[model samples]
Target chain A: MTPLRHVFFVSDGTGITAETLGHTLLTQFEAVEFKTTTLPFVNSPEKARSTLDFINFIAKDAGLRPLIFSTTVNDEVRAILRTADALFLDLFDLMIHTIELELGVASTHAQGRAHGMANQQKYNSRISAMNYAMEHDDGQSTRDLARADVILIAPSRCGKTPTSLYLALQHGLFATNFPLTEDDLEQQKLPSSLRGLENKCFGLTSEPERLSQIRSERRPGSKYASLAQCAYELRQAEQLYRRAQVPFLNSANMSIEEIATMVMQEKNLRKPTF
Target chain B: MTPLRHVFFVSDGTGITAETLGHTLLTQFEAVEFKTTTLPFVNSPEKARSTLDFINFIAKDAGLRPLIFSTTVNDEVRAILRTADALFLDLFDLMIHTIELELGVASTHAQGRAHGMANQQKYNSRISAMNYAMEHDDGQSTRDLARADVILIAPSRCGKTPTSLYLALQHGLFATNFPLTEDDLEQQKLPSSLRGLENKCFGLTSEPERLSQIRSERRPGSKYASLAQCAYELRQAEQLYRRAQVPFLNSANMSIEEIATMVMQEKNLRKPTF
Candidate 1:
């Protein structure tokens, strides 16, 4: 068994980006056990000094160099953390210099600009998108169907709501989702509400075995959780997608982020040039 | 102004984390212009070789090395990428060696484990929480009030819905929110639906100027969007929080990520020691 090691993600802002990067890297090495901690909003020199001291203490106690993943952009604060007995991976300083050279421009070296609340329009758009996704979830509010940027059609519990919400939150795209009902599946036809709006429609399907496993958690031993039902629904959904020429993806192996992004990409909801 | 440079974020999995970290780092260099692109699920050696070739071509075209931020774990793939004519910063390879040395364990050298669909329970919990957040968003549904791990109270458009959704999507926390209506503000009392759940309640307040600006976009110059009304509502909300002993934060300067994390930390809805 591998010994547990200390992992710290420190940042001047929310620390989410640091944690996401650090955690993804750590997940690559399977045998190691990591006790990870995140310390956010360490924007000041004093705070950085104290955090470095704490990391040093942890290194001494463990008799190994603790791993540090940091995203602080301030030079004074970063200098303080460099003194700690750890492998300091300063994400900002590592690549920004090369990018500056390539761009042939001086950097601002400003703090808190990444996720700053400076753009009210973008922020409001995200909020409004979130609300729109929630309102139109599971075909609840079809009144504003014309306003939806992308409409997801899938059976119940096939990862629709979460992906819809993710698209809205991450990209400020208005997304709505509908659960394909039994009648629609039986006839392999688009739901009446979704007939005229096929241009912006996207479909999500999955393997029947995996879909059964997922449905079993919510409704044990019911027909809805049966493998046969999942297979039938998935087959009908695919047929509908093919007949209607609507682009679709199988969500059996992809995460919510992957599904949301692929739909956004193939449907041209996000401008790739941007 | 800086020259335009191509920036690539490559990953074996979803690539969201790599893009997030890279984007945050790039934001600090304000004067530089970046054309950022993400390539996800780069898990194979053949794909890695093709990606390297593309990167080298971009380098030759622009007369400068493109910047790549990658999280690929496989050694064979990393070696292929190292031959590219670009400044390669492989986030996974950067720290995995130190972690393996500290833990004294051989790595599994896995691919796609970062956001893989391995843990079904945790993934389902996140979905459930997102649904819960949507159901109880902005005083929408109070039926399952007690099921919420945290309840946020604030005036209209004070960043409640986004924060609640973030807490759920990131941490699998069941969060609900309600807007403090004018009657509650005038009386300076917790809403009747939220009175019993005061122990789990949190509050968000922002500057009157910012609040007015945010509200004016939704309701064009209504009393709710007036500066004086915003100030009055904010004052009453603070008073109510003090009387109820609910912890609060000023969202005027913080992002949705920061607000959600701080609330989760202070409310103990999450185990901070973890």
Candidate 2:
């Protein structure tokens, strides 16, 4: 039987950074099964002690020393958590010292700074980008289409909306998506709303089988969910993209992260500075 | 003048894991200015060499040793990146060895597994959650409100939409948001669509001034953007939350990430296993 390990992502902030790095590290070890939990905002000595007790209890119950991925920046809190009966890997402690030495400066050791609302302008821009994506979603309105950093074009159910939202939310990019309609595809040209914006447009296509499956969940046994219809739309969309010289991607097997990254790279879109 | 540093987040996959950790770490050092860039999909020795070259060029141009936080899992690529004229910090290499020793196993050393579509079911769930958030945004449709893991309720500009979308996108939570209308606030009752789901509802309130400022950007010089209106709505919303026994938070000073994390923690909502 494969051994099971309990992993905890402990941080003084959102714990997102710890969880993200921990998950990425754990994915490399395919032989071990991990049961993971995130304990965020552990900024105080009291919370740190309780967290230690919980980890020690879990270690004793599981009969294995649990693994901890922590990013605590407080010296007092870090001291409290250092005694956990686990493989305590304080991520910040492990690297901050070296960074301090290299840069000849001391870390502030402040808690909850990683994901706080410290930069109001960046936060507002992020929210604005999200609102832009929402307003321009599925070509709902072309009122401010030219203001977009990138516009994703795809056939319906080909993974445009999620990618658009991810770009806006993650990168603070003014992203919009438009679903290719039959009229646009039949004409073998870009959508009327996207005629002169070919340079700012990116297209997404998916395998017919995958597209059909996705559409079937939304509207079962309908022409829109038919494989033939999906294939026809995809072919026409690809042709339109080629004729318009808009960079495109096949998103059948790509996650939204991958698609968003590819689109940003292809379009040379830099995230709005935060 | 604060010292300026060039930092690179280099990775074999989407580089998000690298950038996330690097950013979190850099936030601790407020005395330095960091000019950051991300180089993703550096899975090959060729790409790694080019990455090294770029770092070297930047270091030479800026007359400072660049900081490279890398997560490349391939030995060949890591070897190439190790030769860069910078402070090379391989995140995976630093920690993967310890983890392997603890697990009594060798890592897969796979590239691009962190954010790829290795698990299709999880990807599908994330997409589905995003779609649910969109379909139920601002109480657009309450058809499947019961299916939501958590419902966010707030005034129109109190930040319900971004929080809802973040919860769905980041954590794969079935999150729906409802903008509390004037009638709902005056009645001091939950939305009729959310009457039975109070336990699953989380309220968000902001400072009156902050709320007014945000609304003013949307509809300038309107009653909705007035300080009196914002204060009245917030007071009523807080009363409604207390009366209904629903948990709430003040989001005036919290980022969407912070808001989502707090909601997940308060509601005891676990991210669906991927």
Candidate 3:
């Protein structure tokens, strides 16, 4: 049996970037089991040394060399962390050096700039986008449908709300979602509020079984959660999407991230620049 | 003046991981300006070749090498992209190779696994947490506050809502936020509903000037948006936090990510494991 390998994501900031990249890399090695930990806000040499000690202790306890993925930008703290007895992958140091050589410029090596509120304008806009999404969620307010970058249309519980919130919070896009009611689906047309916004409308459909299962968790044993009703609603929603020329995707097997990415690409929505 | 460098994030999936890490790396070089683009869903060799052509064209047009940060896991596609006329940084290839050697096992080299829905249970919980956050936003409903992993409290416009949603969506934590009302501040006590949940509570406070500025955008030329009102409210909230012994932070300058990470750490909230 393969032993569980220990991995550490160490960063001077929130360590989210290191953890994100590290998780993606670890997912590639499916045969190996990994126990991962994140050490964030390790901005000082003292903190770095203690983190190193903790990592070494874990290595000794696990009887394996732990893999360390670090993004610490402070020179002194990074130097301290580099002395650990493991495969220390310095994410920032090597890449920053290469980019510096290529650009003929030296790096500032500043810490906490990656996720800090450095650009107030962009930060404020991101918050505003989140507000926009919350206000417009589930067709709550169609008063400003014209302001939406993309409007997701789907039957209830087909994964519209999460995708809308993800787009707004992650990319600062003005996204909104609307649930297609039985009347709209039976008519096989876009909702009245989305009449002229077909260009910005994206539809999501799910497998009948999946939709029924999700709805069952909300309202058990109801016709709304029945497989027959779900299948009918999805079939009608797809027909409406085709008639309206709205791009759509099946959310049965896709994550919200994947769904959001495809919607953004299909609608030519650009992520807001900081 | 520094010449602008073009950077591309190429991936077989959503390319969010590539863009996120690449953005962090580029932020270290404060002197250089970057014009970045993301090419997501590049899962084929044909797509890789076309992406290479695009990167090379930009390199030629700019008279400088364009930087390519890629997370494509397919061998054929990655090989084709490696031939681009730029500084090609393959995020997965080198790290996976090293990890494979360390573990003495071959990587699956699977495409689209980074952000795919490989784990349905975790995905469902994340969606549930998002719904919980939305239901409990701004103290909208406290019916299930007992199930929340953390509760964030602050006066209006102190950034409680966005932080709560981010905590739920990103970390899969059941998070709820309450906007401290004038009555609660005047009484200098926790809300009646939050009386027994002090251990699970975290307070957020913002600078008076910043709070007033944020409120001014929402309700211009109103007493609620006045600097004096903002100062008084913040002071009362902080005192309430101290008296109730709820851990808190000043959110005036911190990004939502920073604030979320700090709250998680302080509250000892472990990110849900898949």
Native A-B contact fraction in model 3: 0.68
lDDT tens digits, residues B35-147, model 2? Answer: 98889999999998888888999999999998889999999999999998888888876798898898888999988888899798888998999999999999999898889
lDDT of 1: 0.83
DockQ for candidate 1, please give it: 0.54
Error (Å) of candidate 1 at residue B120 is 1.9
DockQ of every candidate structure? 0.54, 0.72, 0.71
**Pairs with steric clashes in candidate 2:** none
Error of 2 at B267 (Å): 1.0
Alpha-carbon runs more than 4 Å astray in model 3: A272-274, B272-274
What DockQ would you assign to candidate 2? 0.72
True-structure lDDT of candidate 2:
0.90
TM values, all candidates: 0.92, 0.98, 0.98
- Report the Cα interface RMSD of each model, rounded to 1 decimal: 2.9, 1.5, 1.5
- Per-residue lDDT tens digits of candidate 2, residues A1-274? 7768999999988898998889899999887888999999999999999999999999999999899999999899989898988887877877888888888899988788878887999889989999999989999989988899999999999889999999999899999999888998998878887878888899999999999999999999999999999999999999988988889999999988889888988888866332
Cand. 1 TM to true fold: 0.92
lDDT of 2 at B205: 96
